[model samples]
Target: MNAPALKSKCLPTYLVIDTSSSMKSHESLLNDTVDHVFDVVGNSPRVAEFAHVSIITFNTDAHVVLELSDIETVENLPTITCQGTTNYGKMFQLVKQRIDADISGLTHDGRRAVLRPAVFILTDGEPMDKDWATQFNALTDASWRRRPHIISYGFGTANATVLGKIATKAAYLATDVDKEKEAIVSMLTSLLNTLVASASAQEFRIPDDVPGYTRVPIEFVD
Candidate 1:
């Protein structure tokens, strides 16, 4: 009789980006940074093995740019186009849906032990939808077993209060408006560093502080 294959733990990581009109000016840089992050993860065998990445972009509506995939096997990364309004409600709903589907797919055959998903949200503007919080609350409900650990990055006209509410783990807001480009770079860099560290530690880890941004205090309801 043959021995059973050992199961490895996998992290379902989502990169949620706001592709609203406000981000149009920095679209090229945004796409490049996203590609770079993927390249770096693909280069690292351990990180590639542990972190299954997915890309979700939202503007007037939300779309899944890439399904949860093993970094090493992905041949081409999709580019993000900046347009439309920033609909936070749609984004949150899509994320919740994706988390449910992705988790089920990952654990279907018992081949991999799926860890709690982590979502990295990068946005440059405020939510256009007033009822966005309803969707957000549903996505982050503590009673839900697969609720993701969300880390949000804000820049340009991004709202700190909104970021604080959106993030379950950590939130960061740019301190200087004049240095928006730098802030974007720093946010993506911190994400890459967090992934590498988490993979090595075999657990999810977030930076205590991010450069060009200040950590926002997340409020909890008792």
Candidate 2:
């Protein structure tokens, strides 16, 4: 007898996360930002269907934190604690690896080739480790660069100059860095909502290359 066919389903996927500390005074909201994303994706049809998600977190160290999975179980999204300093180089590398690993599984699962994963990187502080530039270039190598859309959003007065460079061409400053948690949540909703829509798609269209305005709109300059 033949074995049952594995359920074949398309997956709209992306990475959403917070960057290093911003405005040391308000650094405690990083986990809230991640939780807000989970709540948004968990509740939305745009992201809940076949759209899977992964999370990466960085502060003094970088980590994959979460793996790609359906939003149904997304409530288990880990708490992102704030400690140490920023390590942009390590964080970018972690992101690259996560995507690369998932690509293999997607190919074998009879799933369609993916749209460039949308990466929403929200940060309020700078990388404590300066090797970030070299790491950024390596991760931005043509392969990874072409495969994912990285958007850098700064909150609580994060340095726009820095966020701009990380996001490449697409970057924005949050409306309120002091109250960055709510701002990050709104940004996460737009990103996940779009990703959910993308997953439900038959063919991957480069999603709107623009950042949808959020609860508190920030001046986006790239």
Candidate number achieving the greatest lDDT relative to the actual structure = 1
* lDDT, model 2, position 88: 83
**Candidate 2: tens digits of C-alpha lDDT, residues 1-222:** 985465445453545454444434444555665566677767875556556677777777787777877677765666565556666877887777777787677656656445456566867666677778777776667755344666776666467668767874366666533455566656666565556556566434333433432222223322
Candidate 1 lDDT over 100-197, as tens digits, reads: 99999888746457889999999988999899989999998989999999999998888899889888899999995367888888999999999999
Cα RMSD to the true fold for all candidates: 1.7, 4.7
lDDT of 2: 0.61
Candidate 1 segments whose C-alpha is farther than 4 A from its true place: 1-4
What TM-score does each of the candidates earn? 0.95, 0.74
